[model samples]
Target: MDVATVKKKVIVVMGATGAGKSRLALSLASHFPAVEIINADSMQVYRGLDVLTNKITPAESQGVPNHLLGNIDPSVEFTCKDFRDLAIPIIDDVLSRNRLPIIVGGTNYYIQALVSPYLADDVVEDMAEDSRISRLTDVDLNDINSASAFKLLNEIDPIAANRIHPNDQRKIQHYLSLYSTSGILPSTLFLGDTSRKWGRADNFRYNCCFIWVDAALPLLDRYVNDRVDSMIAAGLLNEVFDIYKPKSDYTRGLKQAIGVREFDEFFRAYFAADSSWVNSLTNDQVSSDDANMFTKPKLSGILNSHDSNTLRALLIEAIDKFKANTRKLLRRQRRRLNRLKSDFGWKMQYIDATKAFQDESDNSWSVWVVEPCVKIVRSFLLEQPGFLSSTGAPYNVLHLTSKDLCTQYVCEACGNRVLRGAHEWEQHRRGRVHKKRASRLNKCQRTFSVDQQAAKSADGELNSTFCNSP
Candidate 1:
């Protein structure tokens, strides 16, 4: 079967949040003589935020040697680069021990970093010595507007600047700092450096299979909704409430999990609910200052003056928002995976997991999941392009990694531009700001739900969920 046809190896299972990629990886471990699964998930690296993050349970590990799960406190920072630094050595160690390394995670960016080339720590340290970024860090970033800063960056490093979005303030600032400190543009430094340079696509160290698990949109929507319901039934609310602090910043590591942010409006109301109605919702007292954390203006506006009935209604709405947001994230993940294939020439073995998922308590997962995965992995390793053609994914190019696809989006209606990728587009299309502009421009009736009106506007039906966000 040419199972060993691939080079120094690793197996990465990547997919959306609820697509069962972790389960598939564990099931596949049974076929290997020895395999260690390393965590590449950004959220799962945090110690708490377990149920909300949909962390793999101990029962689900199946006695497999798994690394990096729940290893850090949620408050600390972790980045894609940090993930790559931690995972690459593990991959090397597993290979030295004659064991395969299988990395399964919902974070595609982390997986990309794990496999792609990067600068060595020493080289990075060397670059950091008297580096522009190092100098700029101590300066007040707020003093410069993003537009002016990006323009300055463009003058200094137009090639890199063109590739980086103007709205990406952090990257723009970094570029400016690099130019100011090193006296060389970032693009020039990256390309021209001959000694101890960070790795690029041409530098990836492993011969591996990147398994992309996906499903049709309707099936994915159902899966996300069902998972959200399961999370609730499994006490997701209390799990979040237990670890939550009124002062916790969402910019921190684990706070970025989809479940945490989507439930913000409800938590805010519960925190600042009317004293007369507070007992109806909770036995504990909450401070009004906590209300400052409520940032979603649309949702906040709906629950004006948080009364008992209002809090209860917002609770139901939070559930729907959670489902909607998760569904949206799944869609975004699919888009990113496709972009990964296009940009990095990732040899993706696509799995329609909705078809593979089954109710088999007595039947081993090998039959339903592992067998099919083995077939795909073997085909990929053998370089049998036609083998996966029948599975709707074919190995074509096995190439190097490049920068991620740009995330810039421009709104013609409102001049609301962002570098936040698909979510920005989703929010703009589904949000009230754009709809209001459209209503005034086209004279379409301003309705309670933009999705309903959009469905009607597109065809003669209401397509997506009718939950409207203004």
Candidate 2:
């Protein structure tokens, strides 16, 4: 019997942040016989920073069971593997009860790991335990300079280095760590196997129906900015303040949340400039106050009470940066989704919520986004034709990608900008910016050649006269 036929069903709701993924998932619960939502969001797993992480409230959950959400310790590092290990049993239990498991979040990797059984990183980790392989126990990530680390990676495993940016210290360190610990080149782990690169569609653990909630960039930009302001009005600053500690590592755990580090400079300046305010907001004093007292209005009143023009300015700048970073994250998520659909050939039903977002009405949402998604999920559950597991890989540029993944291109026209893979290099070469820069450089070189020729001719004339006179 085909595994696809026996495989259980799982619905995945994915989107950029602020795309209303959680809302859609909750709405989905009412239509099903029994539904349990497992969170795939990396940050939302942490216990604290509820408002900052944009966790769904108990009231907002609409009585549907939500697992792995706001339940983990904030200080501990929770990885995709950890999420996968925890979520699989929960999903199995949900399936045993014949309930639908709906995985929802902005975190794509966690979803991928749960659905696909084969992943490169997981395989490499398994291989690391071989007794023959030597381990480097003394490696300190902080001491490894970005340039030197990348250079070392290029020397040892140029294929891996080619795929990663020189400035991507994390990936560089990861590849180096794998090499040192496993005694194997990171690129060779795949052995040019395209299926294991990220995770192949053939090794799917369950029958998954992917629904991507997307919006127009212009509208999404506006919505996210408004959402950030609303978050502030809903006490985003209070959440940040609660998590704030001097010199806390912003790169780890819940501190990695977007709103957390953006306020670091503002908070530092605010406390430094006002000793009295610092005294007023000590842990004991803050604890004594009503939890709701730190609302946006009260915080604003407090800031205004002090001589805090500079502090207010810093706060405004931080808020602006937070909004800007969110927009950048939106673009990156959009790009990654496109890549998953195109390069990896994941079958995803794209539901454009642009009109729904524009109208901002429940009626519009039900008609535009919810109805179509419900229909798709209904078909998937029934195992209708064309709604079965997506095992067919789309014929794409992926045939060339195996080698391209190990190739690097440096653009001389763009002041030696490095682009990974042939596809990116081709895209860069065809871009208007690169074309204009190349044209300008070519014209300058031609002009310089003419000037040099003219100067030589003048020198010849002067030399001829001097020779005749002598």
In model 1, the worst 10-residue window by lDDT is 193-202
lDDT of each: 0.66, 0.80
List clash counts for every candidate, in order: 5, 0
User: What TM-score quantifies how close candidate 1 is to the native fold?
Assistant: 0.68
TM-score of 2: 0.84
lDDT for predicted candidate 2 compared with the true structure: 0.80
TM-scores of the candidates in the order shown: 0.68, 0.84
Which residue pairs of candidate 1 clash?
117-199, 118-199, 119-198, 119-199, 201-401
Model 1, stretches more than 4 Å misplaced?
1-7, 119-124, 130-134, 137-202, 274-308, 357-368, 379-470
Give candidate 2's total backbone clashes: 0
> Looking at candidate 1, what is the lDDT of residue 111?
74
Q: Per-residue lDDT tens digits of candidate 1, residues 169-286?
A: 6567656655555545576544533322232233445766778876667877887788888887676776676556665555457886777866677777765754443453365454
